[model samples]
Target chain A: MTPVLQIKNLQVSYYTDAGRARALDGVDLTLTAGEKLGLVGESGSGKSTMALAMMRMIKPPGRIEGGQVIVDGTDLMTLSEQTMLKARLSKIAYIPQGAMNSLNPVTRIGAQMVDAIKAHDEGSSRADIDRRCKLALESVDLSSSVFKMYAHELSGGMKQRACIAISILLKPKVIIADEPTSALDVVTQRQVMETIDRVQKQIGAAVILIGHDMGLMAQFVDKVAVMYTGRIMELSSVRDMFTDPKHPYAQALIRSLPNLENKGVFNGIPGMAPALLQLPGGCAFHPRCSKVMENCKTQRPPSTNISGGRILECHLYSEKA
Target chain B: MIKLIIRRLLFLITVIWAASTIVFFIPRISQKNPVRERFATLAISGGFSPKDLEVIIASYNTKFGLDKPLFEQYTDYLSSISRFDLGVSYNKYPRTVLELIMDSLPWTIVLLLVTTVLSFVIGNLLGAIAAWPRAPRWLRTFATPFILLQGVPPVLMGVLLLFFIGFKLKLAPLGGAYSTGVIPDWSSLTFIWDVVWHQILPGLALLLGSVGGWTLSMRGMGITIQGEDYVNFAEHKGLGGYTIFKDYYLRNALLPQATGLALALGGVVVSAIVIESQFGLPGIGRVLDAAIRSNDFLVIYGVVLFVTIAVATLMVLMEFIYPLLDPRIRNE
Candidate 1:
């Protein structure tokens, strides 16, 4: 089956007083139709930058330097600013980090949802738009009455679900949820994830879930990608990723989680995440890698396709080849 | 909501009572009889004093209920005021205070109310555009001149406008509500046009001075509002710039500005008095100025009470409009 979304050589930089910070450096990823990819990393690991760059929502001071985000065979980079607006939410919908303050408090939820639908499909009737909005709300397990409610009236979980309802209004080819459940309680988190999972399946759209919850990733996503600095260190099926992680950074990240065998102990990777402006030479993860070697300090690793459907980017794998 | 309005009405009555009471008693503290004051000017001007001048003053005071005990005078004043019986003017004589107010109030309301609202609209729109990132640089800078003009006091601004635009340029009439020869004709559109034409300089003075303040405050509010997540989300929803600007950006920014509008209404009469007197317009401000000069206690109390009621009523109306604009204030 053909992939629905393909991002190649994506690079984003922020020009600050100190220097240019390479937030996303030559990243590549592909998601097939109906596939779910969980993007996990530490804070400042360019996870959200990747999501923003995909939407071409990067503001001033931060620029998408170079990239080809081809969604459903259309290069989003080539579209005009006006067309780019239409492309967003219609081609690639984004569910924002909805812990708080996503919806407009002054307007009713129905107007918010209806506006998004109207923005894309201008010719649709008010009745048609209302039907679609209520339908989407219902699909997310929210009551149809929520359409008439304000953002403040809804509970936190309802607001998150309302955001999900808005994201799926057009049923875009790819959905990028940026830590959608970070503010939710564990029970509500599961409900929201299930809602996202159900909606993605219904729309047959690929989803990129960005968060630090590895357990949630294993439970929900088909594949997992571990990001370090600005690059994806490894992309693998969730089974192999948890069973046998290849990149030292990915291995340390998985090991950091509390497992049955390691009852009370956590194995956090040593050393701080270096600032993007001052990233080390060659390999970014070298200083913190348990398997650091001389070449690891001087030579950058290329992404290698190993046996089975997996991708690894590490000097250890490259050295053997 | 009904309860709220009732409470607000009761509160409005209390405020008017307190204000009118203060106006009534403060002028009396000087213990100078308005009747005597009125005739004293006449007596001094003629260079001859009537031997029974005190008798004439006493008869006038008793006629106006001013000769009663202070407490009885206050109660009589409250009762008469409640009945809307503002006594005859001492300076203009024979014309009741209410008649004087009724004659000039339309001029003040039409000019000051229109200018206040217009400045608010023009200033806010300019401010919003100035703060909007998508607006062209020149369009954004359009609000800058207004901001600079905001620091100029209305009085000075009026004088300068009157001097330059009125006297030198002759772009508008020097002062007065209308031309000298024009007969007062409410049915004639030309009469209305002449009235409006005469007000241009004073209106411009008030507009130029106050528009800048709205632009300054609105620009600040616009900047903060554009950064809100809802505005950003509106863009991400693929909304047009206009849609986001109006619904998400401008609508939210206007919440605090509406309160500013309410507070700004209180200063309307003050500016009107300054601009009207400078322009020689016969608005209620001129009436108040003449009343204070001649110590026409009834006229002073009448005009002050009228202004107090209008402002108090408007502030209460703004409170009602507030909940409509901001839903958070509703259902409380």
Candidate 2:
């Protein structure tokens, strides 16, 4: 089956004061229908940038230097902003980082919803719009009264849910959620995560979940792709990757997690992700990898497929597919 | 709320009283006394004897109630103010200080109020447009020159522009609210045209300096507010421009501007003096300047007291209006 979202050899760079910072480099990924793929990476690993590039929402100083973000059959990179906008909220909805920040504080949430809903379908009637808004809120476990309240009145989790509701109201075929639950408290995070999972399943929309916490993403997503320094380090079924990861970096990451089944000291990743502007030669993660060898410095590894449909990029995976 | 109002009212009263107290004494404390100046002028010009001068001074002092103790004099001054009697102008010789102020009051109000509101509205709109993310750079390119012009002092601008635009270019009248040949008429059309013609110089002076500051401030407010989460939310929703303007820019920007306006109300009244004098416009500022020069104490006192009270009252009114514009303040 054709993928719902196809990103081919995507590269994004920003012209900052310090010079060109490669936000994403030669990254390739895809999401199929009803697939919940978690794009896992630390803060500067380009997960968020990839999502923004897909929507053609990248602002100045940041440019998608080379990329083709194909959603359904249309390539968004070639589309005009006006056409991209029609695609943006309707074909692929984006739940931005902070839900509260994604709402107009002075406007009623319902009015904002109607505005977003009508922007794509100008012919939508008030009654139908109101019904859709009510259903949207209800689908996310929010009461219809919540729509009357301004953004400031809602708790962090409720705001996130409301944003999610707005995004899913049009039943976009693909949803790019960038760190939706990252800012919420543990209980609220659980509730928000549950709501996202429930909604995506009910709508059967492809979800590109962007986050840094592997453990959290593992609990909710079907597949996981680990990123480092703007490059995908590993892509696999979450179960297999957790059970028997091939990449040393991925293995170290999973081993570093605090296991509730065993009492032990939990260690975070040894070093930070490489700075995109000053990335090391060859494999970017080689500097932090304990199993690093001399070959890892001069030669960039081609992706090698391993057990259970996993892909790893390392000198150890030097062989091509 | 009542206590707050009472407290504010008392504070305003105290400020006005302090203003009157200063008005009564600051001029008297100046190196030359009005009595001595008048006596010397008469003596040098060979008009009066020593006894005549002394008698004249005593009579004038007694008539103005200046012969009494300072506190008693203060009470009398306050009482007269309460009774709406601003006393007589010594230099103007016959007209009461109240009548002089009343005559000039309309001209100043027409110039200042109209210019202030115009600059504020236009400046803020331009500022908001200039700060928009995808807005054409031409907006800022065009707006910067106006802001630069606003920075120049109003008196200097008023005089220079008056010379260039009025005298040299001969586009408008150089001074006065109406032609000297035209008699003061009360017909609506005549009144409107007279006010408009008279407003030209002073209005330009006020707007040239003021519009820039308002534009710069409003642009700054716009840039800051655009970063606000609520504004970002609106952009994502792709709402209409007017809705964005009202909900995002106007709602957020008005609070700071209102607070500035409260202080402006006080500062604004004193500011027109230089421009008013430059234009030779019959306004409180020009009268106040002449009063200071001639040591016409009653007229000077009357102008200072009236402006202080007007400013104080406007500021109090601003305090009441602030809460409605700013939810944060209202909640407090």
For all predictions in the order shown, the interface RMSD in Å is 1.2, 2.8
Tens digit of lDDT per residue, candidate 2, span A1-321? 779888898989999999999988988888888899988767898888888787776788999999788888788889876777677677888887877577766567898788788877889889999999999999999999987877777889999999999889888889988888878888998899899999999988999999877767889998988888788889999898789877888888788878877667767778877788898988888899888989788788887777687778987876544
Q: Residues B1-332, candidate 1, lDDT per residue (tens digit)?
A: 78998999999999999999999998888888888887888888976578998898898888877889999989988999899888789778899999999999999998999999999999999999999998889999999999999999889999898888888998889988899988989899999899889988888999999999999999999999888878877887888899998899999999999999989998898997888888899999999998988889989999999999998998999999998999877886
lDDT by residue (B51-125, candidate 2, tens digit) is 667788888778766678868977887788878789898777578998999999887877788887888777777
Model 2 CAPRI rating: acceptable
Best by lDDT: 1
lDDT (C-alpha) at residue B10 in model 2: 96
Cα lDDT computed for each candidate against the true fold:
0.91, 0.81
